[model samples]
Target: MTLVLDPLSPALLACLDHAYIDGQWLPVTGSERLPVIDPSRETVVAGLTGATGADLDRAVAAARRAFPAFAATSVAQRIAWLERIEALMQERAEALARMLTLEMGAAISHARAAHVPFAIAHVRAAIDVLAAYPFETLRGTTATVREPIGVCGLITPWNWPLYQITAKVAPALAAGCTIVLKPSELSPLNAIMFAQILHDAGLPAGVFNLVNGTGPEIGGAMASHPDIDMISITGSNRAGVLVAQAAAPTVKRVTQELGGKSPNVLLPDADFETVVASGVMTAFRNVGQSCSAPTRMIVPRDRLAQVEALAIAAVAQIRMGDPLDEGTVLGPIANQAQFNRVQEMIEAGIADGARLICGGLGRLEGLSQGFYARPTVFSGVTADMRIAQEEIFGPVLSIMAYDDVDEAVALANDTVYGLGGHVQSRDLEQARAVARRIRTGQVHINHPAWDAHAPFGGYKRSGNGREYGLPGFEDYLETKAIVGFA
Candidate 1:
């Protein structure tokens, strides 16, 4: 399982010292350099610096300046722009995939199969939604027109850097809103490449600007800036709160895709072998880094033994190793801090009396280096346990036994987070009934295919506003009622 770090490519290296601003690579205006660490080897592959105050000011101002014309752009023009961006992204998909693997320890296979492809999917979805959207509607004696919200401040997370960027940017562009993006300082190489893609795709100056910095620096600035009309952020609830607070002074709109401890409830009639195994894999996918990952598995108490056996078998199939290797299924945790957090949560689960079924504490066998984590599973997890309730952004699964359907639903909806949930049932009506009760943005029945256009956001503390599809595109728009204009 020992693997050497992939050497930094020259193109990625060249992207380190500068950023894309006003549609060009500009020198960093700040002195502090943030090292981009490869989580697999815990090595600094490259460095990034935050946009200085003046630099952030310039970028925001540029977006503000370009908003008028961009907002006025015809729908056909916006669609064309999206098509071009999608084409460019498709061309560089493999390179971006590699950058993701190197910069954030995503498995090479995952980066190719899930990460890059889904990112491209978002752009394509935006195009399709925009083409058919009704920008103007007549109601009674008034004409309701949807216009661009104006300059946008986008802050994306490291977990799905490119996907999140495209999720925000593509929709913003399709809605005709110009944006300044602050990608995660941790995994920034892909952002660097993405800015280049925008440039190659001929995105107008200031229509899409890139700035790399910490939340307090670039994120705070963008959220607080009066010229930036809306700020969409995807990260932890803590980060989302900070952004919302900062933006409040300006009365700017803030959209967020934050954390989740989503539930996977297996109904009594569900087949334990198939459902448990699939649930284990789903929960552990992306090393459990996904915001909507089903980390909590709720099952019928009578079938706990059967579920545990199947879950153990599922966990055994996972191959944890170097991200670049084709055989590797689970890679290392993306960063040191997250690595430590996962470890802490695993230990807390043990201390909290949750029975550890397999995998616990420390690196994978003989894998002395890197952030490689043990694919862990815990049974007998109670509702109050930290392992069951908190968002452990690692490959850990907590299995809780429920006495009945009501208890199962209650357990699923118990958390403060309502980002995502899953229900398994043989009867479609039963599944639908259970799905309606869970207080989350989206629910999946029988492990359905991912819908790129479904509206995705959370309820409660998981954050606000939706992303994906027409709703995502429209989130960047403002409504205008032209009175008596029908």
Candidate 2:
């Protein structure tokens, strides 16, 4: 199927005038530029105004100036503003969804349903959390207060642009903290649109700012800036480390949600045909770009062949082509580099003695122009294989057979990164029992609907901090004990 470019709404397009800094959209000191790409067709979608070190300084200074007043805003006032933003988001949901679909390569159906609805839910969740949060509590003579942390440097990734942005922004606003957002250069169109929603919602100028640029220039500047009190980032672990190193000198808070190599352990008694197929489907979803995708499937040795067969059948069913096709399950890898990376990993797996049960290299026939990758599956893989230890971040699944549940747990926890995991079993008690042994931050007994109210983070080198629920709101706040008798 040929790709169809989704047009952006006029109002959404108007937000690109300039970065919101110092109470207005100020032009940048540098004329560097970045272009958004539609990976499904390898086409340039939109051009975003890029920033320099000087441009970042301007945005940070504005955030610093607005901090005191913004942080002093009453909870009631913040709620009202959030309400307005929520309304605007719903009114413009289709346009925003189209932008997300085009820029991030999500199907329009998913963008409209999953992405947009989830973003709106995040907005509502923040308002709800703020309304009920125990911001002020008594610790005997000392009254504890959760105060806004100050100007926040929010850096989000390209995978789930709108979702990650709201996961940070909604909470930061709820905490009465101002922010300067540096969304991923690859998918900046919708983020720019979301910023406009806040602007049109009557938010005070300078309360929320956005600068578009690569990580080294804008993101590095924001993290190292002395005046910024906290930095919250959602991206790769490499990016997390860089942000932390940058924030160390200033002694500011650094919170990150990084990469993952999650596991999906299918118990012996579980229906291998059903669970294994579902596992393959989950790993292939979103073209397997999700941080928490169950890319590694662990099955009992006795059932290894059974699971592999099911996985192979599922991978064969994936339609790798245009994302716009309602029938297409596997879209192109996000870019040419990702395509090359997945191909290299496939070659590595084959070289390292892992058996290729299904796909191994190159694009699907007749669609070589795009960054398309065939849904890949490998079996006879040892947990220590490079593919199992590392994150391929593509629609590739590596199946490893285990002797017992203990071995499964050990293999799952062997990774340095622990972001998410999956436990599939026929018995509810057995699934719960397995979930306890997993070391990841969030685990799914099965493929459960994402709870808007759950905490999401990672352990080990996967980075720190949580997003969603009350815990997610806390990332943008600091604790203060105001001791006194009123």
Candidate with maximal TM-score = 1
Question: Across residues 1-486, which tens digit of lDDT does each residue of candidate 1 receive?
Answer: 111112366655665677677877778879898988888888887777767778898888888888888888898998888899898888878888888998889999999999999999999999999999998999899999998998999999999899999999999999999989999998887887777777877778889998888888888888889888999999999999999999999999999999999999999888776888889889988899999999999989989998888988998898889999998887889999999999999999999999999999998898989998899999999999998889999999999999989999999999999999999998899999999999999899999998899999999998899999988988998999999995
TM-score of each: 0.97, 0.95
C-alpha lDDT of residue 326 in model 2: 76
Model 2 is weakest, by summed lDDT over 10 consecutive residues, at: 1-10
List the lowest-lDDT window of 10 residues for candidate 1: 1-10
Error of 2 at 145 (Å): 1.2
What are the clash counts of all predictions, listed in order? 0, 0
Which stretches in model 1 have alpha-carbon errors above 4 Å? Answer: 1-9
**How displaced is residue 339 in candidate 2, in Å?**
1.7
